[model samples]
Target chain A: MTPQLEILITVVIVSSACAALGVFLILRKMAMMTDAISHTILLGIVIAFFITKSLTSPFLIIGAACMGVFTVYLTEMLKRTRLMAEDSAIGIVFPFLFSIAIILITKYAGNTHLDVDSVLLGELVFVPFDRLVVFGRDIGAKSLYVMGTILLINMLFIAVFYKELKLATFDAALASVLGFSPVFIHYALMGLVSITAVGAFESVGSILVIAFMIGPPVTAYMLTDQLKKMLILSILIGIVNAIVGYWISAILDVSIAGSIATIIGITYLFAFIFAPKRGILAMIHLRRVQQIEYAVKSLLFHLYNHEGTDIEKEESNRHSIYKHLHWDKRFLERVLKKAARRDYLSVNKEYLKLTPEGRKYAIKSYEVL
Target chain B: MMFLESLLRDYTLQIVALGSVILGAVSGILGSFAVLRKQSLLGDAVSHAALPGIAFVFLLTGVKKTEMLLLGALISGLIGAFIIISIDRYTRIKFDSALGLILSSFFGLGLVLLTYIQKRPNANQAGLETFIFGQASTLLKRDVYIMIALGGIILLVVGLFWKELKLFCFDCEFGKSIGFSDTKINLILSSITVLAIIIGLQSVGVILMSALLISPGVAARQWTDKLSCMVILASVFGMVSGVVGTLISSSVAHMPTGPVIVMVISVIMFFSLLFATKRGILWRYIKTRRDSRDINECKILINLYESALNHEEVRHAHKTTMLKPIKSLHYLRDKGYIRRDYLNTWVITDLGMEKARNSIDKNRGERV
Candidate 1:
């Protein structure tokens, strides 16, 4: 396979895995912990590199995963204390670990390939060059293999523990009574997150890793309610972002990771504006249209209900009803035309009168309101 | 002893130490409010968001004056925070997404700008990277003085608004019911949060500044239940972490002060998490164990009383072989729950028998 195919495959695997894990994190409100893990893994990577003196060492992944877990552990430990909130705990721990890694890089390994920039930002472009060869045959990019394994593991874990995860995510007390250990599930999910972070760090870098983990899942969440549907939607969104983001970057000659992240942001924006049932625009438009329809119906209903009154008794001065109702003339005219078309009202010469159907519809609306 | 004397003697080190303490105290006092409001991530977001502002200022002015740059940073950070709040209020997007959105976009924008600035013929842009990871060594007397003064102003504001802050955080609806504008309170609280982030950004850098703000609040939280006490303790924790971190970094060869400071704060947080009274892990463990042990003892006594009741002669139950049970039973007997006879058997004492019956009655009550 070509390098381009390798890169695409890597992006798909990594993005899907991140998105799958992102769903739970976003639901549990632990997205920032994923961000924290991404940064803290730097310390693990640096330490591993210092020991093995090779970036390709398997120890790097192991070390990074340990640090990622350490981040979660520290955050949990801090949270148990009354002195700090969960966000503060995450805020406090990861930066310190990241700083230590940076210090080590600048002091001892400054001349080496290990540096703060590469560790924090990563080289997504170089991901395809780092091939994993077996028996003199190029198997594919090492990142693809690593991320693929991580993705497979995540999928399996999610499948096996779907019920427990759902129960814990939605209501921990319920899960506890059902003989499901929420804490165990939580730690297991976090562990999967760590491994995924380590795998994705090589291909996407730490900064964009958050976007991968948070964006697609959040977008999917806005569009669906069912956990199964959400997971599926998130994976689909992730794969779309990877492919579209990659092509966009290739066309624009910009950073692939940045492009992917920007694409994710754009996708979220689109979802925000257009997603059915929950989109902001849809809600606003629905509310406006409902209000307009209500106003029109209410005016006609009030007039029809008070037929014997002075305003309704004088059918020759029907335009005067607009004044009593305090509605705009233009709106009244438009509503009158719509009502006439629907046979809700009849206009004769210079007067307006409601038909039997219009009267019924207006009364129904008023009653409902 | 030598290190202490040397630390006191060096004026620059003393300034750095004093500056860090002041910064830490400020962050701690404000952080108590931030943590209470559950806006802890706001500090992190603002700090990251400030990057674009700093980069923008540098790009526009072509200068590296800390004050001017920070002013721009403050404005942009506030804007970012405002955007976050507005997005959360208006959209279905959750708090985390809003935070992520502001954080990534602002930081990404900053990076793009920094990269652009680097390609220009400007030497001042060289130190922009330092903001990503702070350089505490570059702090001078002016920086120290600014930190102290700003920190003092923040502390004063916190002191004056302590009651209002507490009321707003504990119950905003109540605060509003009592003629307080929740919006105004929120604005004030968020402004303070943004101010804290901006002030700390210069010394702690973007990545670690949030830690400086949060860690002390966390550590202090573990030690106290009262808001006032938590704030004071958090300030003290922050100050100590700052001072110790600065000292460690200065003393150690090639140590980055920001990370060192963060590490110190983390250590303090860890200690408080494990060792604080009432809610600490250790305390909770001990309390749980003690309660379980008491319950177990009660169970054993009840068992002994139940077995004793089955005897033909309850008064002469001392010779019963069934009385001598587990080792814990013997210990319970020594505690006056049971009387041991010469035949290596046991009899339930009147007090023990009564207590055991009451314990059994309580268990039955629970079932009912």
Candidate 2:
């Protein structure tokens, strides 16, 4: 495969794996934990490298993965004390651990290939050079195989435990009552998140891992409510982000991972503005519509309440609502027009009257209120 | 003594240490409010978000001056803070998701801008990466002055608003009910926190700045229950870590000052977690052990007293298998709580009866 294709494939696999786990994380309200894990895993990898003296050793992966879990463990331990909130707990632990790793790398391992820069901003341009060869047959980039395997593991884990995970995520108490250990499931999922973070670290670095893990899932969440659909949509969104981000980076000659993160941010922005039910636009429109309906109903109630009374003869008029209800002229006109179109009320010269249907609607609204 | 002498005599070391100490103390004071408000990660978000401002200022001016870059960082950090607050207020997305989104996206933009600058022939971006992993040793006397000025301003603001901030954190609803605008207090508090983060950005960098802000407060929490005391202790912890970390890193080759400081604070936090008087793990463990031991001892004494009440003599052979073994009875005998009579049965002494009565009273009090 071409180098571009290789990079794209690897990015997609990593993004999808992260996005899938992100679905669970978002549902579990543990999305920021990915950021914490991504960072603290560096300390794990650095310590592991110090012991084995080889970056390629599986011990590095194990060590980094252990640090990821350790980050979660420490965050939880701090949170359990009730002295601080969850985010504070995370904010405290990861940086302390990550700083340790950076210091260690810059101090003892400075002469080596290890440094804080590459750990935080992995170069995709270098991925193609490190190809895996089995029995003298050249294969794809090492990142591709590594990320591919991680994606498979994520898929398999989610698939097998989908029901239990869904149950635990949505209703932990009920799941526990049904014999599923919510805490066990929680740690297991965290373990998978750790492994995925470790796999993605070398390719995308840590910050973008948070981007891919949280962005697509949250965007999908804004777009949909169903878990199954959210998972699928997030994966699809991740693939698009990977592919589009790759091309943009290629054209602009910029950091591929960074471009990918920027693309996901843009995607989230769009979802935030334009998603059908939960989007800002929809919410505004819904509020506006509700306001109009409310104005019309209250107008009808006003007419109904004052009907056949001397007060109605004294104060009730078509233009009086603008003064009495303290509504703007434009708002009153709009409400009047809507109410007339709906046959809820009619205007006769100077006074307004509610139709029988409008009377019923007014009474119902009053009863409900 | 030598370390203290070197700390005072070495001008460069003194400048760096002074800068770190100010950064640590300010971060600690603001961090307590941040941690209590559950906005601990805001420091992380705002600091990371400040990166773009640094890059933008460097790009626009082609200068790498500390104050100018920090101005840009402050603006950017405030913008990031604004984005987080707006996202939270405007959208259904939770605070955590909004934080992660802003943090990664802003940092990503920063990386892009940084790389863009690095590619330019005119931009000498060698020192730019220092803001990611801070190099405290690189700080100049001028930078220290700037930090001190900023730190003083921050401390002044905190001191002046101490009562309002305390009420705002402890019970915001009460503060609001009493005519303090919660929104205004929140805005002021958030602004100060971002400022504290921006001042520390050059010393600790973005990644670990949150640690500077958060760890001190957490450690201090273990040692005190009062907010004012916690804030004071946190600052003290922060200052100690700053001095010690700077000294240690200066003595060692290639040791980064920021992480070393973080490491020192972390050590303090760990110890506080384990050994603080009121809420430390060690004290809680000791209390648990002591309470259980008291119950066991009380049970044994009460059983012996009951056996004596039933019969003229409390026989060691009496079926009190539910109680501790015969060795405990022997232990009570040795302690003079029980005496072996002519029949080889255990008899409660007057002192033992009084002890049993006290134990029963204590148990009853606890139940009540």
Per-residue C-alpha lDDT of model 1 across residues A230-282, encoded as one tens digit per residue: 99999999999889978976775556676677678678878877888788888
Query: Taking the tens digit of each residue's C-alpha lDDT, what string does model 2 give over B1-368?
Result: 77899998999999999988898899889988888888888889889989989999999999889899999998988888887887787777888888898888888888888888888878788999989878888899999889888888888889889999999888988998999987678778878888898878777888899889888998898888899998999999999999999999998888888899999998998888889996898898899988776566678889877776788654444443554566677767777887766654556788888889888888889999
Residues B110-134, candidate 1: write the lDDT tens digits. 7656765775764468787777777
Could you tell me how far off, in angstroms, the CA of residue B232 lies in candidate 2 after the best superposition?
Answer: 1.6
Residue runs of model 1 more than 4 Å from their true location after superposition: A1-17, A73-89, A99-111, A125-192, A223-263, A273-277, A287-369, B176-184, B296-368
- lDDT (10s digit) by residue, model 2, range A101-168: 87888778877887678768778888788899999999889999999999999999999999999999
Highest-scoring model, TM-score: 2
Give the Cα-based TM-score of candidate 2 against the true structure. 0.90
Off by over 4 Å in 2: A291-359, B176-181, B294-319, B325-368
